[model samples]
Target: MKLRKPVIWFGIAMIMVMVVTGVVMFMEKVNVFATGTALSDNGWKAHFSEPLAKEAITNGYVYVTDRDGEKVGAELVLTDKGRTLQVEGLQPGNYTLRMEQKAVNSQFKSLKKKKVDFIVYDSIESISSAADLKLYFERAKDMQSVSVSEDMAGSSEKATMESAKAESSDAVGGGDHSSTNIQVEGVDESDMVKTDGDYVYSVFGGTSVKVIDIRNPKKMKVAAEIKPNDDYYPTQLFLHDDLLIVLGDKMVRYPKRSASQAEIMPMNSLTTIRLYNIEKPEKPVLIREIGVEGYLKSARKTDGMLYLVTNVHPYLWAMEEIEGDALRPRIFDSNEKEKEFMDFKDISILPGAIDPSYSVIAAIDLTSPKTSQLETKGFLGSSDQMYMTKDHLYLTALKYETSTNSRGAEIMIWNPGRADTEIFKFKLDGTNVEFHRSAELGGTILNQFSMDEYKGNFRVVMTEGNMWDERNPSKNHLYILNENMELTGSVKGLAKGERIYSARFMGDKAYMVTFRETDPLFVIDVADPVNPTVLGELKIPGFSNYLHPLDENHLIGFGYETSAQKNPSGGEPLILTKGMKISLFDVTDFHNPEEKFTEIIGGRGTYSPLQYDHKALLQHKKKNLFGFPVSIYEEGEKEFEVDFTGAGALVYEITPDRGIVLKGDLVQKKASGQQYEEWETQVQRLVYSGESLFTLSMDEVKSYSLDSFKEISTLKMK
Candidate 1:
């Protein structure tokens, strides 16, 4: 009897011990690993001294450490220069010496909390080097190992705006360069999800939108796809709780002129703004239609307010009918330029140009007034441009009514609330032939022509090849507008305007990145907006598409940082460099934003200053420069299934950090053989509500669950 009792006790004790051990290990999610022999003795693989390759390595996550405590704690990543600590979005300026202690040890198992103290050197010199790598967070909710976050920034909220601006300030935005890591809380892989390229069919025009529910990322299902009304063609879709507002061109019953124009040719007179009641997302109902006199092309939403700042839509590319066809110019005496003339410039002038149409600022107050407010949107120039800062909306406008071409476009500020909308306008005026030209660059425009606001001033930056007598920088301009929307000051004649493309604002300075030539980044101290001085320049090879400012001293540049002078596309020896890299710097000394730690974690994609949860969606290497392409990776599966159009996207899990998951195929259809085949069909846009990834391509909206990345439901337009 005594032996039986002892044996039973021992068995119970063994089971209890096993349970406790499992609990401990499960709680200790973070495991420190030693330097694997897989890593080459040279540290970096042979060919990747370039910034992009280095960034990919840094992002590759050499080591994964967890903060064993609350939501906040230090997560140290292995860098060539020991362990660098970042806290509260700031680097602690701490360092270490030849600190090779237990290269990979689970000493963290003893950590009562994630907070641990490591050997530190406060000196800046011993800090080794900064991360010269590009960073981006691929938010994948299905895969926790990726640690990407979503629900960080909302386009329509002020808090979202401020934080989004801050994200831009981070090296991601090129404002603050001292910060390196963009902690994404989710996983972004080419697989892990199945984009069963099958979608339902519909032929509805623009009145269609895909409805999604984003609370539960894992089990999300497509509730419905609705086509509110037939006549209204939606141009853009913005989410508002249950309602999905569609921005489109509508025909006014009283305004017969526009209706008549449309009757003449369906493409002539287009409507501006319209609203749909999406309370039943699956079955969208038309609440009311709001149409302005003119047409609208592109649109964006931030907060509950919808800004359908009107612009011209390009549908006119018709040639003037020739009375008699002849081949020769001199032989026919018809004064012909070319027998087969491909005229793209004149296309904008025909029926597509916005020179004749004016825009309106319609604040669709979804929260307050049932009746939407409308005002003359007094801002101009053309399409593919326009930005809002503070309460003022800056746009490119022609100097006066006399000009015809884009060179007439300059910077202007307008207030939607104000009755007299034209607050101020800035331009560099000169004579072209016999006409006075007042435009962004005084004559012709330059690269990625854009406007940005720093402190209180607005600066215009772009790429210009050659201008007038100058060959270096085509043109760059800076204009300061006060609270009254009046130009308080201005500056022109940029030194490196020709090569630059993307730009961002820091405290009192701005950074401009170049695309062509010796693409170096230039810093401009705009303390004196009228006479802004160039701080210094950081040169990297290839083009600089976007700049994410981590701090005043460091900036993360995305886009290919080529190894050779000529690009691989130009018959040059293909150098497999880092597609995405993070470049750190000591920007406290902005005289020159010094390159510090540059780690290439992966490839580089877009310069979207995106946030979800708390982490930032770092940088992604773009497979294609022009279009949005998504690659899929199955969970626990290695390798990617790259799909161009069916590039599924899910950014619904917005939270304290930048974490969200985007997966699935782009060309989503429900019919057999209707799968996403790049050669057969093209895909449009994608939307997400946690689990169900709703992809709206062409007339179809397909849904996929986050748990299995499988297509669940599909809605075709009516």
Candidate 2:
């Protein structure tokens, strides 16, 4: 009996030891399972619990197959210390990542899991129906965990103006005159000031459009003023033949019922265009008015058709109580005599667009403004920069995705986990506009100048990463896409650690400037649609913000001259801007570009509107003359301080033989104890009519003789 009892206890003890050993072995076996998947610029990443064996990662052990189990040819790379398996070169579709048990070492296992379903897509998917859009909003609300009311706010409009071109006339004062400096030749943009050689039409004090007769330079006088109602304030003007088009903002109020039953009214802003018959300079008659709900994004006139883009953000959160037309954008036409909401059939969603906003585009037949109809369409998305050709219009939007880290903290990051630009293209035919394909590039565009369309291909320059962030320094890239928005060629990883300051695309080549400690101007050859290469590079001491073509082989750069100073923080030297710089670059040699001439003005605190607004510059190509308004400041006795010197307009004659020569200086004298610029006296624009040059400011307009540089007349505007 004693022997039986002892054997029972011994068996129980053995069982316990076996259980403990099994548990230890299982814990050390290194079982792996996919935690999640992420998309990057290079490829798709399948994250696992533990690092994998390098030799076991191969097509035989790890591969991707389509939804039907057909194996896809892709390059497999083990990254993140074998914790991530990268699958590249796969087209957009649903796929399954199959990792065989053999992919793990003999001492490891895969938790008996063989496949992980995933998707490889680069484009955005459109919302299928109203139900789908509601689901989208619900998902967005769930993810954000915030009230939509917090996202609602007032939006401001941007002023983008252009110059005017007049036909050659035989009148005494009608000679070859300069128009608004523009990017495209045939595309006309609206500006605050426009001229038709004999008359200058300008927006004065944002209240009225003034028609100044410039036929007699010494007797320049205001001939007429078109003043609108208090609700409409003019911002820009465009002159087409005998028609004067004025663009401004109009305020509309919506009555909101309060909790106490009181009516509270909120103002909403809309873009309005007023067309006037200016056959007689003295008496202007209003022809018609066109209005669209939202803030004006941009406008372009070509082939006697006007295209307007506006961004409309309605009270989407009000969908909880209100529905239908109340949340949709509206359009007003004088012919209709009433405002109408946009049709649902005319509204489409951009792929991956999460913002509850609409980009409304309207086409007006300016050729017959009196009886023409308005055709407009709305897209649910947001656009930052716009570029257009005679046949196509391109809009770019920056999209960000939300991701969670190891700590479960949500972080907002650019789409694809990099700085990406989502671009949409539209085909423009006369007064008809249609949406084309869209694409996603791995960088952010600088401005409208960063994009261009050539013979059959579209090219763009983008800057990736932040220049101030050392961990992921900036790098520039240039991409070429086909008419269908398919990737054709690219020059990636250019100018590492520097961002693009300026980019300009010529016929067969592209000029780009990137800056950090020094400016590196790159000349890229893009003639071959499938293989673009860097032709040359020039490193200089400053950067260029705007680039203008002087001729076929020459270019002009406008920006700031910078110098390196010792960094008190002790890493890289600090870049100290010295003065406003003008450089003429010679690229006659495709393999070697040279800065032929350079001119710097003032020191420390010198600025010109031409640096930010290209229309502020005056270019007389016939005379090889260029001028802009500048506010000059000099370095003070204390460190990091400057003293205001003066403000005025300066003109220079730049030629290949003579280089850069000062032609005229019309600086306004600073009053005693004037330590800052006077807004009223600051020159804002320079225009030339025949042999006379006019400088316009808020207070007055002054005319100078182009031949003698003598002041002829001054007309008070205020």
Candidate 3:
């Protein structure tokens, strides 16, 4: 997961006094970026140079950092063509590096500041990685376009003079040399897990967990390491049967315009719950991990039943133990009605109604009045719940209204087999539910859903609607019940922004998978169990998140391509887009559904999809071709391009074998499987048994060999 370079952790005499006080004291360090210099609307062309920058033009340059904003002391060099940035030994205070004062070509210009303090052992130095790769090509000139290839550092093919449109537009034409996205702030990472056979698992920081055994995918062996003495980590998980359910420290969803911003998740790591017990194939037994008492964030489990939904903590720990010792944080227990939290900020609702949250985090204080420790400025937060079936633990609740205008909350079905009860709460009768603020372009607005169904009846199917109103979707509310609990009634007009990620009823029509501007597969009728009618929709361009039904008239839609584009020559492109079809479609004409087949998986042409979230989407069709495990990095410098997502969680299986680069049956040679491979160190999640595969590398647990795959020993999780 590593890639967090704010120079590792900022502070080299406050970045040599903000880069020698922004160029000897502001007056010439405005909006600077070099490689070729950027900030163009057409006023700063071709940015990518080292020994290249005299065709000069700049209203920016001067930088330094270390308060968590690395790039210290002096650096504004193009050293004849190799670029240079030697900022002395470092040790300063006030700093600078400002850019904003452009009318020359307007890409935006309105920021400037340059403060100084330079005083480390005779003045800072050292900026050579090649002068920090030439100020990262002048901050990749306005950052974020990622490969359009004009020469983009040569080598994706295109330097020929043998023109014929140079192969019709310099290498495939849609144009992109692939490489850019440098928020470079600690190497932009979130998930990493790759295994066809040889073990690999990851879940880092915010807390930690690891395991590895590359089984010779070339070599990497580290097996075993899981820490949680009680600090909080593990944000998402699901591995039923042998039991291994973990989901901690969350901020998973947020956009319903501040869903009551409190960012909860901390009390003894959310009441601490690790619970491992891998039925020992080679040894995996944490035995029993239970840290009971509410506030637990997101989780899912079936064939065992454990539905949960809680963040009701408003108790404030007996008055911070009588004031003066005031601390915060309360882990595991979003269920059981437990309540005693302080702040962690959580507000997700994109499928409908919920908002409020903008900077609030404080939770800490496990069980015994554990002395002082609550220094939160870190902004750690969490939300989003679903424990599909292991007894049904669903979540989404509201009741802290701030002004009125609708969408408050109510939808939290828990039934861990009764002993852990709550069972019902659909909420939303309208007094005026407005809840705005989550339109970050397509993410939060309350749209929870559930269905793994062993016998079918109804585990969950949430909603909130008005998703820009796409043809009246029955308005909202469709709770259908069955797992022997029964409700089977209340499927009304739901078509606002369509929010039921999956429903597939069929015997009376149910389809579902709704969204507002994209991601559609609607088709409702519920056989009229109460009032469910929409009967036709199917958009599909990207954003279905997850869906599979196969029987009942054939239905399967994985589609998920994120958005954001404008280049004909307008530039601002930023795509990471991943998750493509296995599609199939044939809803027996849900209003005309007949596609039959399509398959194209993995990064290609991506121009705008800002990472798309809700854990982006994973699969559990058990096996028929469903994938979600990624690791694709377009990586650094074209200026603000930042596309190195660490790349690795890729669980591929949809192969009748046509091409993604295979053919090693054991090895006759042709193996390109397109793997991510960028590890120097850092892996903390991956699980799968039977054919073999397991991982975690903060300490232990490594086994592998799904055929010819490698890596064999290293157990410990206990």
Top lDDT: which candidate number?
2
Sliding window of 10 residues with minimal summed lDDT for model 2: 162-171
TM-score of candidate 3 on Cα atoms, chains taken together = 0.28
- Tens-place lDDT digits, model 1, residues 1-718: 2579889999999999999888777543221111110111111110000112123223432222222322222333333223221222212322111112223134333321121222211211110111200000011111112111111111110111111122232212222111122211111111101121222112224455444443344344455555545565555444455554555555432212343343443233344343446554456566554543345533334345454445532122221211111100010001222322111111111111113223333344555324544322322124334455323444443211111111322112111111011112222111000101112222221211245555555555432223222322245555555433345565555654343455656657766654334466667777776677777877765544545544344554444444544554775344433243334444566676655554332233312222111122322222100112232221222222322222233322211122122332332233444333442123333433323444444544455654455777654433
lDDT for position 434 in model 1: 12
- Total backbone collisions for each predicted model: 140, 4, 147
**Which candidate do you rate higher for lDDT, 1 or 2?**
2
Cα lDDT computed for each candidate against the true fold: 0.34, 0.75, 0.34
lDDT rank, highest first? 2, 3, 1
Which lDDT value does model 3 have at 614?
Answer: 22
Q: Which candidate is the best by TM-score?
A: 2
In candidate 2, list every pair of residues with a backbone clash.
161-190, 161-191, 162-190, 163-180
Which regions of candidate 1 fall more than 4 Å away from where they truly are?
1-207, 214-220, 228-231, 250-266, 297-304, 312-357, 376-384, 398-449, 454-456, 462-473, 481-492, 549-554, 563-588, 594-718
